[model samples]
Target: MLTNAPSVAPVPTASAPVPTDSAPVSQLAVADALMSLLRDTTTEPRPDIQLEALTLAVSADLPVL
Candidate 1:
């Protein structure tokens, strides 16, 4: 079963620019960002790791490609 879980955005550093928009970002967007981060963090190109991460992300109700 899939469920929507609360996601917390990463804090920006002092040099990072803050957004001017007052509107809240969507959960899907947050999930996508997190997925990208996870992919980038992988040192080697392993299909198994990617597949497992994708499966876990989907099962956790995170938007994944």
Candidate 2:
């Protein structure tokens, strides 16, 4: 069906930064992530350690939807 479809070239992405011997993130960032997880655990109705309810709960909680 296509008569004049142009060939698309793959775009090259920026090179990843080289990691040093030290950790990238600051200690505060790690603390923030831990706090977020704790808050989610306490406030949100977390799903149990089951395969069935897990998928449903995650889908229900999607921000895009």
Candidate 3:
């Protein structure tokens, strides 16, 4: 049962603030960010309608097909 692990005790520091439910970003914001990324990397015509629909569906907790 020999081990080389150190037995150092951790020092406690000030606790970080906990985020609330409201702190989460809005669904539209997330979608917008994703869209930006896609548009930057893609040269094809932007799939604005499809992307928006997907974002809305995901945000609404609806099943995507």
Taken over the whole model, the C-alpha lDDT of each candidate is 0.61, 0.49, 0.57
After superposition, candidate 1 runs with Cα above 4 Å error: 1-7, 10-21, 44-65
Q: Model 1, poorest ten-residue lDDT window?
A: 10-19
In model 1, which residue pairs have backbone atoms overlapping below 3 Å? none
lDDT winner, 2 or 3: 3
Tens digits of per-residue lDDT, candidate 2, 1-65, equal 48796643222222222324583544445455555556656466765666555677787895333
When summed lDDT is taken over every stretch of 10 residues in candidate 3, the lowest stretch is 8-17
Query: Model 1, range 1-65, lDDT digits (tens) per residue?
Result: 34685547643333232334785555555556666667667477657888899989989999987
Q: Count of backbone clashes for each model? A: 0, 0, 0
Estimate the TM-score for candidate 1.
0.36
TM-score head-to-head 1 vs 2, winner? 1
Question: What lDDT is reached at residue 42 by model 3?
Answer: 45
- CA lDDT of 55 in candidate 3? 99
lDDT of 3 by residue, 1-65 (tens): 34886543222222322334676444445555555556668456766898999999999999999
Task: For each candidate, give its TM-score against the true structure.
Answer: 0.36, 0.29, 0.29
User: Per-candidate RMSD vs. true structure?
Assistant: 15.6, 18.1, 17.9
* Global CA lDDT computed for model 2: 0.49
